[model samples]
Structures are given as structure tokens and as C-alpha cells.
Target: MEPIKISGILSIILGLIFIIFPVFSSGVVSIIIGISLFFFGITLILAGFTASNIIIGILAIIFGLLFTFNIDAVSFLLGFQFYIIGIILLLAGIIGLISDTQISKIASVLIIIMGIISFALGGFSIGNPLYAAILIGVCLIIQGIGMLLD
Candidate 1:
């Protein structure tokens, strides 16, 4: 019922999908990320709060368009996905640990571990998106469980 629980459920479902159909999920993830970035870029540009924001927004838009339009680029860029996910998870864990958020200490640690694992996997399988998809799925499942527990 809560937002966290809802997120957990969605994460678990997505994780299962990723594990079941790594190839499909990988492509879909790339497209989804592309679309999200596109919209975020649009928002940033519209906001025009600062010059840096506008610059980053333009870059985001360019990359978003590239990712959305080119599947080949997505395949090649898969290696970076792990690093991005790892950094995000690491930051989330650190924030959770520092702040009184819904994420408990244990969950935060788990997230941090997942982040480290993601980085390791990325390093090992820089050119393999299928492996990355499966690993990302496993990490998502663990993160979902952590969220549920929290």
C-alpha cells in the first residue's frame, strides 16, 4: 500500500522480466532510459534555472535522442549502464545511511554491496549486455526485497 512497497513490487516484477528475457529487457531498458532522459532534458531546458542546467539538458537531449533512435548505440553503451546503476545505488545507500529515510541500515548496506557488485560486473563484461541484464535483474530483486523490508 505504501510507496515503498509499491516500488518493491514493481522492482520485483521488472527483475523477473529481466531475468526471464534478458535480451528484450536490455533493449527495453535502454529505450525507457532514453525516453526518461529526453523528458528530463526537456524539463531542465524549460526550467532554465541556470546555464549549467541548460547545457546538461541539451547534452541529455542529444544522448537521449541517440539512444532512442539507435539500437546499436544502446548495445554499445550497455557497459556504462552498470556503472551508472552502481553509482546511483551507492549514492542512495550513502544517503539512506546518513539520513533518517525509509531505508534501514541493513538495506542500505545491501544496496551498497549491490553497487559494488555492479561495478565489478561492468568491468568484467563491458561488451556483454546479456550478462549485464541478468546481473541487473538480480540486483533489482535484492534491492526490491530490501525496500520491502524497510
Candidate 2:
């Protein structure tokens, strides 16, 4: 159990590194995801055929077809994934504050602060994404320069 847990943690660390780097092989990730989906769908289709289940077979084929054909949907799905994660965190913090101890109460406070920041960013984005983008870029540049000077 410890070995499996450690392996899972290591996998997540590697995944975060790949995500955070200035450059990443998005195409490679996409290809891997597609392959997994394809295999999963194929397995489902085979199972459906064995059971003479037309609906399951059709769903599998449709999913398989969509995996490659619907790139935009894939992007949307990934974006939605982030949003869902944020919501989950927000919920957890709220729940923890009610049910847990001193540390969790503080965590909720920090989470609330982060949620406010996210809201502000989204509010600014609503008015002008270009302006928000430029502000973010400039902020990053300034921060990078400050870090170097330090």
C-alpha cells in the first residue's frame, strides 16, 4: 500500500512538472489521452457485442469517434476540469471550517481570500481580456525581474 501510494504521489509530481514548465508536449498528452479513450471505447464495444447490447456499442463507437474528431470539446473539457477543481476546493474549505479545528478554520480563511482573488480576476476579464492579459503579463515580468534582483 505504501509503495502504491508513493508511486501515485510521484506520478502526480511528474504531471505537475510537465504542466508548469514554460513549454510542454500538449500534443503528446493529447495523443496519450486519445489512445486511452480509444482502448477504453474498444473494450466497451467488445463487451457490448458479447452481450448483444446495441446501445453500449453505439456509445463506445461514438466516444471513440469523438475523441479524435472533437479537439475543441477536449479543450473545453480540460478548462471545465479546472473550474470544477476550484469549486471542489471552495466547498471543502467551507465544509472544513464548520466541521474541523483551528488549522482547518485558517485554511478556509485562506481559501476565501483566494476565491476573492479569482473573482476579481474574472471581473476584470469580463471588461477586457486583452487588458487583463497585458496586466498579468506585466505583473509576471515585474515579479521575475524583482526575483532576479533579489
Winning candidate number (lDDT): 1
lDDT of 1 by residue, 23-42 (tens): 88878767775776678567
Candidate 1: stretches off by over 4 Å: 1-7, 71-75, 80-125
Tens digit per residue, CA lDDT, model 2, 1-150: 355455555554544444454133333433443454456446544533433233433543454454445466655443232233234335445644664333357877786566555456555544433333444445555544444444
Error of 2 at 67 (Å): 16
lDDT of each: 0.74, 0.45
Error of 1 at 122 (Å): 5.1
Per-prediction TM-score to the true structure, in the order listed = 0.59, 0.39
Candidate 2 structure, TM-score to reference: 0.39
- Of candidate 2, the 10-residue stretch with the lowest lDDT total is 78-87
Which residue runs of candidate 2 sit more than 4 Å off their true CA positions?
1-89, 101-103
**Distance (Å) between predicted and true CA of 20, model 2?**
20
TM-score of 1: 0.59
